[model samples]
Target: MSNVTLHISKNFKELLQFLKSISFSRAIRVGIAVTLPVLMGIQLGYFEIGLALSFGAFWSSPSDVSGSFRHKIKGILISATLVMIVSFIKGYLHFQLWLLLPVLGLLTFTIAYISIYGFRASLISFSGLMALVLSFANESEELEIYQYAVLIGVGGLWYLLLSKAWHRINPKAETEEFLSETFLLTSELIETRGKLVNPHEDHEKLQSKLLKLQSDLTTNHETLREILILSRRTSGWSNYQNKRLLIFVQLIEMLETAISNPVNYHRMDVLFNDHPQYIKRFQDLIFEMSYQLRMISEAGNDHRKLPKNDFMRQCFENVRRDVALLRETKYYEEYLMLQNLLEYQEKQFEKLKSIKRLLGDPNSTEINVIDRKKAKRFIAPQDYDPKLLLRNFSFRSTIFRHSVRLAVTVMIGYALGSIFAFQNPYSILLIVIVIMRPSYGLTRSRAKDRMIGTLIGGAIAFGVVFMIQDPYVYGIMGVISLVIALSLVQKNYKASATFITLSVVFIYAILSPDVLSLIKFRILDTLVGAGLSYAAMLWLWPAWEFVEMKESIEKSVKANKDFLHKIIEYYLLKGHIPTSYNIARKQAFLETSNLSSAFQRMTQEPKSKQREMNKVYELVVLNHNFLASLASLSTYIQHYDTTEASERFKTATEKIAFNLERVVQCLKDKTCNGAGASSEDTTLFDDQLPVFNYLEINTLKSNDTETLRELQEAHLVWEQLEWLFSISGRMLKLSASVKLD
Candidate 1:
């Protein structure tokens, strides 16, 4: 019972925080999108046309997710053009049912097909939406028909001006929020990673938590790179802000690597599960790291008196003592394991120390950089290259199939509306276009949410109409609804849809004075649209995520293989790791992350579709372990100069990469024969092992103490390589087991 109360309290607090986080900047931008245009339209005695103009403004809102000041400005221009083109086409073909029907069909198909490109998709989706609005306006004369387009263009342009104005006025606010959020998220990640080191921790539950953390981390990092890196590059910030930002960005990336220990906690548990003395101290060390992360955040303006790493420096003595004890007890393997973990802790401490020095003093000696690759900008704006998209386009694409299905659904909905001679013929048409997606599950989910939202929203709008006696009150309500809708559309689709429904209804009550009929038609149209969407999803190109799961696994294998090869190549080069090598590692980890995320989604799917669920889970776990082992090897490479490269170690790395490719081929070809080639454990680096009695203790332990220390360090790196090979062998076994049937 107490647990339940605490859970509720925690959730309620999060909810409150979420509400507080409502982007006032975004909400204000939304105000300009609808409120300004509506106010202007009302002043011109065009009160009835607010809905149409607001629709145009709403079309431009999706571009707000991630864009620089320049990118934002360019998006607005492109969006405005799209809206105008869509409006012009719809207006020119008004009331010519037979001719317009074919044109509408082609337009829907064209827009849906081109949605393979993300930015083009947004522009085309907005244009298609406005085209729906164009058909809704009651018109006769050519000029009157075109007037609707002009008003919507006014709204689009207004939104553009407002967005630019906000950035010009307060560029610092967004970047500051981004920086604070990144650090705050890092603090959360630190605690999470600390808890993960617990041996008794639930593996599945922790993985689930990790997935969520990773998703959030990815978003924050993208935000960091987009705002901090790009805005500074474009000369939109002060020199001080830019320099400080550059420093912080480096720290953040270091923190990212430090927290990303891919070593299995279970393995840690096995080593220290019986030794509470060792385990407890390790836990304390992690918690201390967590504490430092929070302190960094709390430092705020007082960088001069920020926390120190005296605790970590003191703790390393105990860690070293534990390693010494294990070394004497015929537990050389365990000592090596603990040493690697200590290496990680020490590295983490050094990063925080470096960060502290840079922050407090603003000038520090040449700091140690684990990653020597030069910082490169990762600018990922929406692509506008039609030629590139077309050149790589495949007519056999799933997106293409989805486009055909969407065109069919739209035509069917329009035909149904026309046959019934409905007053609002778009009741079915718009919903069909809006709800249909490439995936059956998504379309079904959207249909359910839209219908639920529309009903509740309509009920609220009806109550407002019954209570309010003034058109001005209705108008005010509409503006508030627009603000709420715009703020949440991307964040909470159902809630946004509800507000949108109420907002549209309120606008009609203010203008048309026929509340009952409007509500009646709106509800009926929504029902029809939702039903049409559902049917199309059931019968049309149904792309199940589970069906594509195998391909995703194959890609994961390929990525990991390439990653291993790159790391080996860097080792061969005996030079600083290149940018391309880092990129490969990033891609591999991301692919593994993607595969894990996909499996989570697949779990949410119907059980019948979740084939080989256990095998898939094992595969994901093995892949994670493989990557984590590689990450451990990365730490080994960091300290040592890649010299006197052993032929055995190089051969093992080569074999692992080759094995991964074979695993991928086996999955693709559905044949595992000769794929999981078992090799003898002859590549064992630990000569102390009873199974490998190749070297004498005297040779490993040199007469000169300093030389002995150097030999031990080399031996540790050898053990790390062997450990990685062991993990790779297991991955091959797991890959062989990954079967759809």
Candidate 2:
């Protein structure tokens, strides 16, 4: 009997603990959600009145997960100040409603553009919306506007504090999560490369994956870079792990390039075959390097000592051989091209060593340059060229799409406001204008989320009003607001939605002194606003066709051709290619990004464009894969250890280069003429004596077995290159046919 009683008691205790845990989490989320809305209501009371105005402002400025706190805060502050000034001017000048309309329109457009470009455009947009709302609210009491600003400021401050606190607790976790995603993507690329049956087809897929990985890796690297800068501001926080993270990122990039162009690996094997130990050692070293990086990331600051076992020694030896082979092959050209990256890693590693040395000494006096200037210098903005931007915009029509969406949004907002005759009809217009947004693709998803969130929020608000009264309600609302603010930190949309829901409820129920009977009116108003916004989105110049997909695929093809031309030119120059190579790389990345954006947009459009968009998306994918293969081939060709090979390698390289030029010319002619051309006319892959003659002439005069073997491997690679180029030309022709049709 005693045992049974004890068991029951234990179970009850466990259940209580679980409920408490859940409640705590709920409180946090609720606190974050209600923080801003409640403050807005408290400062500017009137139940439905202030709540409606605050909702419009908040809706306009949805927080962006990608943006930094500083950027978001700066944008928000700028927007708030502008709104405040506008409000002040309205009171001072007593501007007429007719004159205010045009000014408000201009302000809206400027805010829209800034929001689009700025990290947290949503916030800026909201600020501008608030300003406009205040200008038009001639019926409302003047003091109400100032109260609204004070509340919003309070909410903003509360959210800012919560976000900062959360980040401090888990500064690197988000970065690590992003890195893990990249590593998984890298693994996928390797797996895909191993399964290639048709080199061309597989190569295309590889290129697509490589391009995607490169973009993702670059973005992730930026995040880590930011984190490292932030770490410097906090005493005892180290960026040593981040430096190692950057190294692995570079290594992964090289590996992807290597896999895409098997010829490079073949060349490496050829040059160091006699000393098989070198190749083995190099492989081991790469493995060790990857392992060490993972370890440092996992262990954080507690991690000490590199893996100095026998396995590490073997790997180091391999690294030495790989370096030697790279040097011997006069691959110095390739190394030089990638030299900046190498230097960056070396410097980062040196910094880590310095940090470690400092950590070792309790009284170390080394000055850690953790200032903004140093951070800015370290995290240089990727050089931007206007020409490239123009090229991308011209090819993909991204600007046109955005412009169309914006115009439609305003038109819908005006129509709804004029048509609807609710007590606060402008609220419906505000919702339409603010929610419809700059892109049709994202509008529906966000709108649906907003609807669901608002409904849930209304219910929560009703419950809070019924259960709590006065000061306790205010305290509970504050806690709920904190939770919503924290949800902004997560990547998931659902998290954001939940927080938004919680926020709306608290603002309506607790902050606003609207009577219990008026709760139903508030709910109805929210639904009406959501419904009108949704209707406007569906009917207003609805984008049924995805034109961007076709444009992106077409642009990618052009970018690929340009990249190939650059590679050919670089090889022809023999040593250290011009800066144009980097331009080509950047162009490729931009095209890929455009393709992704296009695809995302297409998914939101009507089903009519689905088939055409899918076909074009496939082509875009193929083009990316091909580009990756080409990049790999370039890396291999540039790094081939020519010292041990016969002169035949050089002669063959020149012949290959010449053939590539011919191919480019033929493609240009075909593109310009728009005429049908036969495969025979293109000399598609016929390995006649000229190709071999070039190879034979370039063979090195060496008697050593290893040297002879290296020469033989070079000849094999040359033959493979010839075959690959032929395949590529045919694929290009096929791609052109699809595009023309």
Best by lDDT: 1
List CA RMSD, all candidates.
Answer: 4.7, 9.9
What TM-scores do the predictions have?
0.84, 0.62
**Least accurate stretch of 10 residues (summed lDDT) in model 2?**
335-344
Off by over 4 Å in 2: 1-77, 85-107, 115-123, 130-215, 221-297, 304-437, 455-482, 511-539, 542-545, 558-566, 569-587, 637-675, 681-685, 688-731, 739-741
lDDT (10s digit) by residue, model 2, range 537-656: 566444433543445565765666677667656655556745567557546655655665566566676675465554555555555555655665455455543333335434544444
Candidate 2 at 720: error in angstroms? 6.9
Root-mean-square deviation of Cα positions for candidate 2 versus the true structure, in angstroms: 9.9
Query: Per-residue CA lDDT of candidate 1, range 53-171, in tens?
Result: 67667666655555346666666766766776677677776556677677777887776666777653555565556555445554424346567777667667767877777777766
User: Candidate 1: misplaced stretches above 4 Å?
Assistant: 1-24, 44-55, 95-99, 130-151, 232-266, 291-331, 353-395, 420-423, 512-523, 639-643, 672-676, 679-716, 734-737
